[model samples]
Target: MTGTGALARMQAAFASAVTDGDEAAVTAHLAGDPALARRRLAIYREAIGANRRGALRSAFPVVARLVGEAFFDEAARRLAAVAPPACADLNRYGDGFPAFLSTYPHAEAMRWLADVARLEWAWHEALSAADATGIDFAALAAVPAEEQPALRFSLHPSVRLVRSAWPVLAIWEANQPGRDGTPDRDEGADDVLAWREDGRVRMALLAPPDAAFVEAIGRGTPLEVAAGSEGWDFAPMLVRLAAHGLLAGFAGPQSAG
Candidate 1:
């Protein structure tokens, strides 16, 4: 193999050993006493496992705290083993964790934990999304009333919607800094709206109508069609969206529908 090819092969073998705990390729590739190589590889594997656990702990602090550190660490390690990092960026590493927790046998007792994980992930994503300018409502108002129905409004990239059958917003807020009271453990469904504001991530519980409106707008649905949806009421939702700087811009009739 050429030098680049040889390096790629070695890297692949190292990844296999570290991620899967398979030592055969590593044992053959390393130049050292067989026993020493195995021991050193074991050390590297342990370090990687620890790193994955730490990454998860940071990403899902509430989840870790709720489960207790020891159990969280073990769960993180097992999750990492199954869903090894696909990229070098750790920020994107825990996308599968929420789903994994839903089916995780040990987490069966804490059914709401997975929903909490989803809320945390949304917050994390919103924090990293790009900044956006506020909507041009003046221009929107200038459009002909008859044509306004075809206008398409854009959502800020930082906005995220997370729906759950648990009171995820209450659970998340209770875990925030300087919080004292326990969450209600309310079984009613909730839809959380998360976005970046003033360079910090903020989350709020959205009523069903508002959630439906925001979700439709985010998907580029036309104003008329979106407003006609089951739970939509244009005026109030528009005011809320504008106040929070959620609307990015709009495409008028000729530009959109």
Candidate 2:
């Protein structure tokens, strides 16, 4: 094999040994006494597992706290075994964890756990998302009244909407540091909006209509259509979003005209 190919093969062998415990395939590449080489490889395997657990713990602290260290560690190990990290960046390693938790046999009783995990992941993503320039109010004011309804607004890149049948937001808030672990109520649905502002991740509980409106806006829906439902005024919501710097920009027929 060429040098590059040889290096790739070695790396693959090492990965299999450390991640899967299939040491026989990599035994030939060992550099010292056979037993000592095996021991060193064992240490590497343990270290890698610890790293995976640490990453998951960081991404899902609430989950860890809820399940306790033993349960969380075991779940983390199982997740790593089933779906190893696809990239070198450990920060992104737990993207699949919420889905994994949803179907996790041991977590079956805590049906709401998956939704909570989803919210936590959104917070993590919002924190990691790129910063965006706030809406240009001067330009927004310049749009003709007739064309305003057709405008499509952009949400900040960090904005995330999560709707769940469980009281996920309340549960999450209750679990925050220095708070009692009891949520105000535990049976109702929740609509959560997560975003980053001033280098901090912020979350809010949205009413159903407002959540729908924000979801529509995030999907690039036009203003008129997004607010088309009768008996609801989206003005306050709009003002609130603007105040929070959630509106990134806007474009529509006016821009083309």
- Alpha-carbon TM-score of each model against the true structure: 0.92, 0.95
Clashes of each: 0, 0
Which of the numbered candidates is closest to the native, going by highest lDDT?
Answer: 2
Q: Assess each prediction's global lDDT (C-alpha) against the native.
A: 0.86, 0.93
Question: Per-residue lDDT for 59 in model 1?
Answer: 87
Model 2 spans with C-alpha error above 4 angstroms: 254-257
Candidate 2, TM-score vs. the true structure?
A: 0.95
Positional deviation of residue 27's Cα in model 1 after best superposition, in angstroms: 1.3
> Residue-wise lDDT of candidate 1 within 144-210, one digit each (tens)?
9889888888988999999888888888877877775378665569899999998899888888878
Query: What tens-digit string does per-residue lDDT give for candidate 2 at 1-257?
Result: 59999989989999999999999888998888999999999999999999999999999989998899999999999999899999899999999999999999999999999999999999999999999889999989998899989999999999999999999998998889998779988778999999999999999999999999999989888999999588999988889899999999999774643
Off by over 4 Å in 1: 229-232
